[model samples]
Target: MAILLAPMEGLLDFVLRDILTRVGGVDRCVSEFIRVSNTLLPDQVFIRVVPELLNGGRTFAGVPVAAQLLGSDPVCLAENAARLAALGPHGIDLNFGCPAKTVNRHGGGAALLDEPELLLAIVAAVRRAVPKTMPVSAKMRLGVHDDSRALECALALEGGGASELVVHARTRADAYRPPAYWERIADIRAVVNIPVVANGEIWNVQDALRCREESGCDSLMLGRGMVTNPGLALAIRAAMAGPDASPAPWGNVRPDSSLTTSPALYPIINWQVLLPFIAEFWRLVCARLDRRKQAGRLKQWLNFLRHHHPEAERAYMALRTLSEPAAIGQWLALQ
Candidate 1:
C-alpha cells in the first residue's frame, strides 16, 4: 500500500516536506504546483520550488519528490517537463486539480477538466518529451463544474500515456469543501487503466479506512489531513498493517463513528514526539523563507495543528498576534 503526500500549493512546500517526511509514514511526496505561463521558465524556477532537486530529488528523510507543473499550453508544459526531468525528480506530476480562481481564470488547473481532448494532448506531449523510464503522472479533480466528464478526463490522461493518476475526489465547484466524492474515483478507476491514487477529505485514520474501502484504491494521498495531524500517514500505515494487539495508542480504536470493522490499530504521534520536528521547521523557516513571511508560516501550521492537539491550540493562541520572527523564536524557545 503506497501512501503518497498530496501537493498542497501554498501550505506544503519543500520546507514542510522535509519535516513531515522525517516524521515518517509517507512513501513519497509531490512538490507544490509550479505555475507555468507563456514563457519557458528557468531551471532555478523548478529548483526554487522543489529544493530537494539540489539534494538528488529527495527529501532529507530520503523520500522521493516529484515536481508538479500546472499549465494549459501542452507544448510549453512538455518543454518545461523535459527541463524538470533533467533535474531527476522521482517523477513529474501534472496538476488539473487546483480549484483556485487565479489558476482557473487563466485556463489552467481545473479549468482544463472541461476539455478532455486538451488533457489528452497535454499528457501525451509530456509523455513523449520525457524519457521512457521516468514516471509521468497526473492529478485531477472530478470536473470543473460537475462530475459529468470525470471518466472522459481520466481516459484522456491514461491514453496520453500517464503512468498513474491522482484523483482529488471533488469538482472545481466543490472547492475545498468536505464530503469528497471518493466513490466517484471508483467510477473513474473503472474506466481508466492507470493506477488511481485517492485524495481529499482524509483527516484521520477512520477517514482513510473508509476512503480506501469505498474508493477501492490501495494507494492514498494525504493533504490537509496530514497538515492537521502530522502523524496521520503513520497512523494510516499502522492501521493498514493491522494491530499488534497491545491496545496501546492515541485516538485509541476509537476511530470516527463510521468505522467499526477495524480496531484502533494504529498508534498516534503524540505531542511530545512532534516537538523536535516543530523546532526544526521553525529553524528552516527562519533560515530559508522571507523574514516577512516567517511568522505567518509558523502560525499557518500551528493553526492546523490546533485542530489535532490542544497544546497547539495554546501555541496558536500565544503566537496569533506575533508577526516578528525574533518574537516567534523566543516563544518557541520557551515552549
Candidate 2:
C-alpha cells in the first residue's frame, strides 16, 4: 500500500518533508499547493514550492516529490501544469481539498467542487497539456457543503483523465472536524477504476488499518497526524509491511534540552515532541514572512499540536510572548 504525505500549505514545507521522509516509510511526497493566477509561474516559484526538483525531483533525502497546482482557470492551470511538468517531477497533482476560506472565496481549492463541469474542464485541460507519459492526479474533499456532490466530482475528475484520486472523506464544510467518513471513500472507489487513496482522520496505526479496511482503498494519505507525531508514517509503513514489525516509540524522543522528561509531566506528552520541531519550523518560515504573518502561522500549528502535546501549550504560551524569531530561537536553544 502506498503511504503519501498530504500537501498541507505552511505546515508541510521542505524542512518537514525532509524530516518525515528520512523517518523511513513514505512512498511519495506532494508539495504544498502553488496558487496559480493569470500568467504561468516562473521557474523560481516552482523551485520555492518543490526545491526537490533541483536535486532531480526528489527530497533532500531522495524521496520522490510531486508538484501540486491550485487554480480555478482551466487554461492558466493547464499552462502552469505543463510548465511544472517540464521541471521533471515524478507527477503533477491537482488540489481540490483545501478548505481555507480565502482560497474558497477566490473560487479555488474545494470551491471547485461546487462546479463539477469546471473541475472536469480544468483537469482535462491540464492532462492534455502534460506529456502522455506523465501522470496527473487529484486530491479532494467529499464536497463543498455536503457529500451530496462527491460522486459526480470524482467521476468528472476520472473522466477528465486523472490517473488517481485522493479523497479526504469530509466535505469542505466539515473542516477537520470529528468522524471523517471513510465510507464515502469506499463509495468513490466503487465507481472509479482509478486508484483511490483514503485521507483524513488517520491519526494512528490502528486508524490507518481501519481506514484501509473500511474504504477498501489500496493506499492512504496523511496530514495533521504526521505533524503531531513525526514517526507516524514509519509506524504506518511498518504496520502495512507485516504484523511482526515494531511500532516506533512515541513521546520518547526530544530535540530540545528544556523538555524535562521522556514523557513530559503534562498529560499530553505524546504531542510534545512536536514543539521543538515547530519552533525550528517557524524559524525557517520567518525568513520568508513578516512578523505578524509568522506569528499567525506559528500559532496555527501550535493549536493543532496542543490537542496531543502538553508542552505544546507551554511552548505556545512562551512563544506567543516573543515578537522576534531570534527570541524564539533563543528559547529553543536554552531548551
User: In every candidate, how many clashes are there?
Assistant: 1, 2
lDDT for each residue of candidate 1 in 1-335, tens digit (9 for 90 to 100): 88899899789999998888877778889999999898889999999999999999988878899999999999999999999999999999999999999999999999999999999999999999999989999999999889999999999999999999999999999999888999999998898877999999999989999999989999999999999998898788667766564433333222111112233444567787677678889999999999998988999999999999999998999999999888888988887
| C-alpha root-mean-square deviation, each candidate | 5.1, 5.3
Off by over 4 Å in 1: 245-266
Query: What clash pairs does model 2 have?
Result: 257-335, 258-335
Residue-by-residue lDDT tens digits, candidate 2, 173-254: 9999989999989999989989999999999889999999999987899889977666676666665657554344444444
Candidate 2 ranges with C-alpha deviation above 4 Å: 246-303
TM-score of 2: 0.83
TM-score of each: 0.93, 0.83
